[model samples]
Target: MTPAAPETIAPGVLRLTAPNPGPMTGPGTNSYVVGTGPCVIVDPGVDDDTHLEALVAAAPGAIEAVLVTHAHPDHTGGARRLAARLGVPVRGCDLALAQPYDPDHRVDAPLADGDVLDLGAVTLETVHTPGHAADHLCFFAREARLLLAGDTVMADVTVVILPPDGSMSDYLASIARLQAMPIDAIAPGHGRRLDEPAATLAHIVAHREQREAQVRDALAAGPTTARAIAARLYPDLDPRLTGMAATQVEAHLIRLAENGEAARDGESWRAGN
Candidate 1:
């Protein structure tokens, strides 16, 4: 299949979609080039030479740094290679948080919330939005009002929040933080850019709340595992997404328990009194 070429989403931002589309990655991972000259590449995508070449080619000027939103393979897999190619530093946060998932994860330049990346015409501030992943981050282009939202929020489907590394409460709080920001557009890790940033963030919060209610109802029935609750809640969920659904359900259960709205009985969960 012919790879899609890079498209400009903002004044100094260009996006190129990687060719690794699947159930988890809608269309494919989005590798963005931010700034006009001496730019930064966000999410280098999978370590495919062709994809790396495409991302480098899409940049309008010298690639200063390779910024990773999270340590997920699809987003950070090619970061090292891309950075090496351009003689730039790989920037991100909390490598240990994602080492279990991506054992080979590494970051030359560690980032924290509020850290700014000044690239001449474009400036991006890192917002530590942990939930989708413990080290997950969203970069805000202050002048353009465009947010480079990783898995923190997607345009098409809800992000899977698995425990140990992910937390439903964290995810919700991250959303709240983003809602409070001055964002006009969102360039997500997957799918297309979101123009109605406020509405999209609001809808995601409402959806999570509704899903939490359903989980509460499911738990009220009796003590059951997260997988069973998932089956009950998503009666027609795609077979391939079964595990992810269960993980999401588990995340909610964990959150409910944290809030004293539910209790865990071994592998099963029951609604709190």
Candidate 2:
């Protein structure tokens, strides 16, 4: 049975919810369909028959391609299955990571910065905004000035910065790139539509900056660890979230150390004066 169709965000764009939901989460992962004819599906979301059917039903007829923003399972789980059902090819970054999604399906196209995808009359421009994940990308509607931001810019919690694949430096640069664009609306991957795009972007930037400052302050208090910084910065947060916070804190610390704003002595950290 097909899952219920997602709410309409624009004239032809629809946002479908994935089946997977983790702890400390609101709503669920979002899969978007842009255009009605020869539609483009973004982030097919987790592997679920219901969700896949819902997505197919939402955009009947031709499904030109399935586009993934990142390789995260929550985002690309259904790419292979959906693409096969629609007889179209999957397109995205990190094809290796996406291989496990479906054995038969291949990444037909590589998504990069400034690539324009025609979805009927509407055109979606691909903006490579890595950080949440190295392969992360966002789609911008030039005519509507709307951004279908993947996990890179969610309305709920800030996207995680997993090392090796994730970089704080790249994430900040991506945010700045988005800020430089003419975005009026943000259709996030996991939350309600954001009308004031500029204000929302500002708030996200300010929040990250404040967290960086807090990390510096924690380092200044004497030799401290990422866990210590997280504790100091989020005293009231749940203990389970401390680990995630520490990861973020560590990302900031690493970035600061690279810039000479902070340094590590042995096993402890200290901020430069």
Candidate 3:
């Protein structure tokens, strides 16, 4: 699919929305080009050839570096290919920590939470927000007061927190961390840009809290499996999304267990001390 022309979203930021749209990825993944003369590309989107060419064409200057918010396929799939094409390095979190563990998902330069990528016009600071994915990172353009929030915060959908790699507690902490920052707008991984950072973050937190309450209540009834709890809570859920719902339920249960509010019994969860 052909990507629309790059739109200038900020002072020196151009947004190129890829063409791999779906229920999870609303209007496809957003790839941002920051700065001029020597630009920095963030989240290269999918591995489609057309999208790769679009990314290259979107940049007004030489592509300095390809920055990945995480190693998720939808975000980092075309990162290496794009970097290789431009002879630039792909920088992101340690690949060893990435989910679905792909050895081919290369990161030439590993970025830490406090690391900064100076792009002359603006500096994009890394903010490690692990919840939706273990290696998720959000880029904060302090000068613009715009956060390049990957899957950590979406414009229209709640991020899925799948356990084993994702944690509800960690997600909340990440949200709080962002809340403490002076952000004016959020360039999320999906959908339109969020202008109300404070209200958006608060709403996300409140929704999670409400869902956790529902999860806790579901558990209090009796020891049950994550799938069972999801079935009880999401009666009108689409069959295709049942698994995702169950995974989210398990993540919530894991957080509850961590807080000593719930206990795990083999494959089931029950109320605890």
Worst lDDT run of 10 residues, candidate 3, spans 95-104
Cα lDDT of candidate 2 equals 0.80
- Give candidate 1's whole-model lDDT: 0.89
Shift of residue 32 alpha carbon in model 3, Å = 0.8
* TM-scores of all predicted structures: 0.97, 0.91, 0.96
> Would you list the C-alpha lDDT of every candidate in the order shown?
0.89, 0.80, 0.88
**Candidate 3 pairs with clashing backbones:** none
Rank the candidate models, highest lDDT first: 1, 3, 2
Which structure among the candidates has the greatest lDDT? 1
Tens digits of per-residue lDDT, candidate 1, 66-93, equal 9999988989889988888889999998
Q: Check candidate 2 and list the clashing pairs.
A: none
Clashing pairs in 1: none
Cα RMSD of all models vs. native, in order, equals 1.2, 2.8, 1.3
In the range 1-273, model 3's lDDT, one tens digit per residue, is: 656789888877889888889978989999999977688889988888887888788787888889988877889888988898899899898836625744578788889999987777878899999888788899998789999999999987889998778889999999999999999999999989999999999999999999999999988888889999999889999899999999999999999888899998888889987
Compared to the true structure, candidate 1 yields what TM-score?
A: 0.97
Looking at model 3, residue 81 earns an lDDT score of: 84
